[model samples]
Target: MTDIFNKIETSFRASLRGEESTDKLIYVWGIISYVLAFLLNKLIKTVHVYFFGTTISAVLICYFAWHIYALKKCSPKKPKLTKEEKQKLREEKRKEFGKKLMRKLLLQESFTKWDPIFISIVIDAFCIAQFIDYIIR
Candidate 1:
């Protein structure tokens, strides 16, 4: 039990530092958080409870924003490559891009962090919008 908590805390701290969460834990966390948010919306039937949705939205927005910032900041600066190396790199990139495009269009697989983060942002925005709608009603 203690080990589990410690590992979770460590992963959280690593993510806060802009590093990826330990292995598969982040996917688990995101799924659990989404389910929890959905349950909260369903079980809590009052307008005041909308605040919970808004709060979750804000937290998620901040987290992904910081995560993106950290990822960009921590990315390695590429050293200048020889022309041949540059050509090889460009060729590799093109191949990778083609693979990704095919995977996205055919297999519906998203391997990049940005895709999930973008989806989360859209959902969070919807949560916020729902909260505002409730308040307005």
Candidate 2:
């Protein structure tokens, strides 16, 4: 983790701050979303699931899963917002961002926001490792 943070700090200091320069931020988001997903999966199994009036393995499923919905509603325009329009848009964007944040935090929606294959591999490895730990412990 420290090494990853170090790498990100290096990347940020050397960044170009453009479209491609988003790689570092994307990388961090990838790590966070996947970790949250796996933990939430286990949490649901260990908490929410029960059978015959007893708690069962309820930590491995998602009920109200988070989902990511892209919003391009605020794309740049040659014309800027009027003050009232700006306030209204700010409120709307605030709500939109809050929902997205909750989804991301809850692992309901992934960073589908990035490369699927890489993300899937990371998730697979995470699951394998978790199963291994479960067996060993």
Candidate 3:
């Protein structure tokens, strides 16, 4: 049991660092946001509460949007290469298939850090719109 817990903790940390797959974290955060919105609708039963929640959710959406924009801005762009250089690179990659595969996997893992933030933004925007409509009515 302790070993399982330790493994889980390690994996969670790795995911936080964008070194492991984050699909599950993304899904869990998305579901939790939706559930919170649903519960707020059912339990709050007040326009003021909904308005407050919507405001907070909108703020979160903005924050996540800014984060994504920053990430995109900070990402390094690929350098331009001539046709012959491209062909040479492709041939080298073909010769080193294992290294190419590893690099591809690493690049995929690195980008996964944004998945949860994107999911959160979408979920928060939806929830904000939902509660705003509820409040308006």
Candidate 4:
């Protein structure tokens, strides 16, 4: 209804401003994209193979450009570190990586970040749709 649409619009605006988590939006979009792709394919009676490819490429380019822009705009300059300090930092990162890997393996960690999940959902939907179409034909 109006309430649902208002929430979606708010979320979309917030996401555009990098002020909101996009997990729900990405999930909803993934489902809608897949459904629409199927319906469009059926209605048109022909697949536009380049359409999705071009769309994905353009999205990726824009995403990377925006990411670079954000990083350049918001990131602090790195401090110059002494050799010993650099080594210590690297050792700490190594230990942290090891612990993180172990935690992930044991399922003690949960990912709340949305980007990887969003990308996987998109790729999976595309692949699954292509597979289903292949089977139907």
Model 1 segments more than 4 A misplaced: 21-26, 46-114, 131-137
TM-score, every prediction: 0.46, 0.25, 0.40, 0.40
- Which residue pairs in model 3 clash with each other? none
Q: What digit string (tens of lDDT, one per residue) describes model 3 on residues 76-128? A: 35699999999999999789987756877888534334444555556666666
Tell me the spans in candidate 2 whose CA falls farther than 4 Å from its real position: 1-20, 49-137
Question: How does residue 67 of candidate 1 score in lDDT?
Answer: 41
Any residue pairs clashing in model 2, and if so which? Answer: 42-59, 44-58, 44-59, 45-58, 45-59, 45-60, 46-58, 46-59, 66-108, 66-109
TM-score of 4: 0.40
As a whole number from 0 to 100, the lDDT of residue 19 in candidate 2 is 23
- Candidates arranged by TM-score, highest first: 1, 3, 4, 2
User: Candidate 1 on 1-137: residue-level lDDT in tens?
Assistant: 99999987876676666565323333555556556656655654554566665665566556545444444443445698899999999999998998788888786896554745445445555655654554454
Candidate 3 residue runs with Cα over 4 Å from true position? 1-48, 98-137
User: In model 1, how many backbone clashes occur?
Assistant: 0
Which one wins by TM-score: 1 or 2? 1
lDDT of 2 by residue, 1-137 (tens): 99988975565444323222333333453456556656755664566333411221122212111111101111122477799998998899988998998898999988568654345445545554554444343
Runs in model 4 with CA error above 4 Å? 46-89, 92-137
- What's the number of clashes in each of the models? 0, 10, 0, 0
